[model samples]
Target: MSRSCPSRDAGLFPSEAEIARRLSQTPQEWAAKAKVLERDGLPRVDPLMGGRFWPAVRAYFLARYGLAGAEALAPDGPENLDAL
Candidate 1:
């Protein structure tokens, strides 16, 4: 008898590299922006993962660009950016 393996779901978040690519910025620039966000009391990056999840990224976009800017960059609605 063959045992079935569970399917793995794709990660629902973008990595720092992906974020940087989307923003047309370097990884270092993204990291610097992340630092500013943290200093301003936004969600901190995951220390262990060295990355931000979709919510954190969304917050960053909103904070940096405002609603209109985020809407322009997000292909789907800004609220749906993190939807899996």
Candidate 2:
């Protein structure tokens, strides 16, 4: 069953509906993705917000793909920076 977020949480964060909308998925599809990503670092839904924290998800993906949070230095120098 879909539970509605109380008024106090109405706009504090994205709800499952909003998240699913952004990903072009239905609530059912979002639920499936959430389950699959649970062990892959996707943030759990904060009951208070009725959804996962969007920034946390972004951070996870960024780090997963080595896009951010890597140590500073190109081990092989700037010329080979893209290879890392």
Candidate 3:
């Protein structure tokens, strides 16, 4: 991906405080998980912009919960017993 793909021009969080705000986590909580988040493929903070790559966060969640990783949909809508 291009460097511009997930940058401040694209609404980057821009600071640890802002990142925590965006993620609904307190600063302490974010700091605690920062390393693990990066280990799991979250983009590293860019020093120049004091921001991280937003697309990486989106990509992570999408891969984890949006499509392939989620529970399968009910076969026949809400009434399908097989889905249970």
* Highest TM-score model number: 2
Query: Per-residue lDDT for 53 in model 2?
Result: 83
Write one digit per residue (lDDT tens) for candidate 2, span 1-84.
Answer: 666555523454677776677668898898898899879878998986566787786677688788867657757644766688
Q: Stretches of candidate 2 above 4 Å error? A: 1-12, 69-84
Winner on lDDT between 1 and 3 is 3
The number of residue pairs in model 2 that clash at the backbone is 0
The sequence of per-residue lDDT tens digits that candidate 3 reaches over residues 1-84 is: 123233444484456665666779987798788878788777888787667767676667677665635566658645767777
lDDT of 2: 0.73
* C-alpha lDDT of candidate 1 relative to the true structure: 0.59
Worst lDDT run of 10 residues, candidate 1, spans 1-10
- Per-candidate TM equals 0.47, 0.58, 0.56
Clashes of each: 0, 0, 0
Per residue, candidate 1 scores C-alpha lDDT tens digits across 18-45 of: 6666669887797787677778755665
Report the alpha-carbon TM-score of model 3 versus the true structure: 0.56
User: CA shift at 59, candidate 1, in angstroms?
Assistant: 3.2
